[model samples]
Target: MKESITRYQFISLIILFEFGSSIIVGLGFEAKQNAWLFILLSMAGGLILYGLFTRFVSFYPDTPFPQVIQILAGPVIGYILVWGYILYFLYISARVLRDFTILISQTILHETPLFAVSLLFMIVVGFACYLGIEVIARSGELFLPYVLLMGGLFLMFVFIMDLPKIERLEPFFNIGVKELLSLVFPRGVSFPFGELIVFAVIFPHLEHPLNSFRYGVIGILISGIILLIISVTILMVLGPTIAMNSTVPLLDTISLVNIQGIIQRMDPIVIIIMVVTGFFKITIFFYGGVTMLQYLFKLPRRKSKGLIGFIGLLVMTVSMLISENIAEHLKEGLEIVPLYVHVPMQMIVPSLLLLLLFIRKRKIQKK
Candidate 1:
């Protein structure tokens, strides 16, 4: 209920949130060499979509996204719509946790069970949620600079170690146009970009709320550049073939950071980037969902504290049960999530809601 976050903090939060899982996954691998191209295009699509979503917010000043939904649609249908977003926020928070847990188990803690890794991570995530968004946004402002600095250094090392082959990106349209375009449609946009909807929940908390849209756009722009740099770096270093095939292309790309034998075994750099960004990412989504719950159920923050813990527990459990294995998880993320959940909840529903907003405005004008 406090509008405490500054515009710069909002930008930092978006950079970290968009860069969270996105840096590790969804690197435009499917498009191969053209992955970065698709990402750039996807970003443009996302910006326009985001602009529209924010416009919806501008209509209802001093309100959260859920209240906007309530205004556009009546309470009954609006609550149903808001519930869809609540589930989405919960799903993505858990999914990001699952990704971190999986990566840790596969790499550092090979002997650790998925549950244990998740358990440890959730403890930190839950504690952050307890502190709430102001603390989380402050943490982002403090840490995102390092993430970006480290990311820049990593990119520089890749280029300095050995120049990536220009030929790797040859045959420009490597994949058929349809195939490449398809990869960007809902999946690419939703994962990092469309997911900006969650920010609407956080946006209402911004002290200079009028500057919300500006910072949000800047956030997307900065994150897009980062994501683009990462995708292209992967393509240039690993080439399209290996980059496309590797499950953790960014890590794999970082693994190649052999700076004249001075900076080998740079796995820790990747881990640092992942953990810091992932923390802010999870915290924001978790907080957003919790705040929405308080609004939806009309619960006080004091009363909702227990509910937050319960939902965090639910996130851990659901993440564990999401898929039998990482392969299935990736497949579901690529095919199912975009097609069904994100497209409807993020893109489609928002469009419908915008139309409804217009209709409501006209009715009011007549009054």
Candidate 2:
């Protein structure tokens, strides 16, 4: 927790986190051709939300979020809010761990047990969190460039191989305007974008606190572009019906890539990117959760290792038992998570904090 990350390193983590499981999870599954549109709209909203978070963090630099929350809302209420956010981080880590495990099983590790895959993955994540934020952010610096390269190569192959179809985007807003905007609120805003809530914990740790707004907005924008390209590629290659139906739309899109009948199977690159980015995402959330726990519960430094183990074990168990199948997990993530957990906590809660902060500052000025 004493270590800090550079602005570019922070941006790298954001890019990886935003892309995380979403690469294959498929967006706007219902929006179909309009998925990329929602990503754009939601990302705009996300930057605005990140702006609000920047304002909030600007109130207190060099302090952790749990303490800040406690000061803002008072002991009882702030503690509850802090706990909820930590739980949110932990739950999200579990879900992503579950997602990567399943994807690995389906694509390359058919014979590997889901438990084994998740356990091994969590072990590395646990060790990273065990080391501290600097280690995790440094790992992002190491892995993200290669991930970006894979993506660029993937795009080159897709275009050179003639896979994307322009006509698939026809009959725009097929679901009508009202429904399209509706998707932007909870599902679109809550995910890839709303997940910026974790950065609240991260921002205070930056080497330059004043640079948070800059790094945060730019990071969200870059990740948004990546998500847009991925969603568009899927829509163009697979069309609406297949995109909505395919468990992993990006993978399906890559499967269609054929460079002069030579480079047909390019799914492995997607998997590699997923695993690398997914590690950063999970480790970040884990770090967020552990840091918050240590701050809120007053765990001694000597007991910090115990705290890490408890968190890792709990997330592993929750991930394994969370669902009976991938279909159920997708349904819950799309329907349940955004509506109940994401909107109130991720969107409304932070907005309220800013409102309260504004009022408190004004009252102090008047005195």
Best of the candidates, lDDT: 2
lDDT, candidates in the order shown: 0.83, 0.85
- State each model's C-alpha RMSD to the native: 1.5, 1.5
TM-scores for all candidates: the values are 0.96, 0.96
For candidate 2, lDDT tens digit of each residue in 1-367?
3678998889998998888878878766678877878888888888887887788767787778888788788899998999898899999999989988999999999999998999899889888887778878888888888999999988889888778888998877777778988888888988878888888898877999878999888888898888888788878888889898889888888888777777888889888988887888788888888889988779854478888888899999999999999999999998899899888878788878888888899999999
In the range 218-291, model 1's lDDT, one tens digit per residue, is: 98998998788788778887888788778888888888777668879888888889888888788888887888
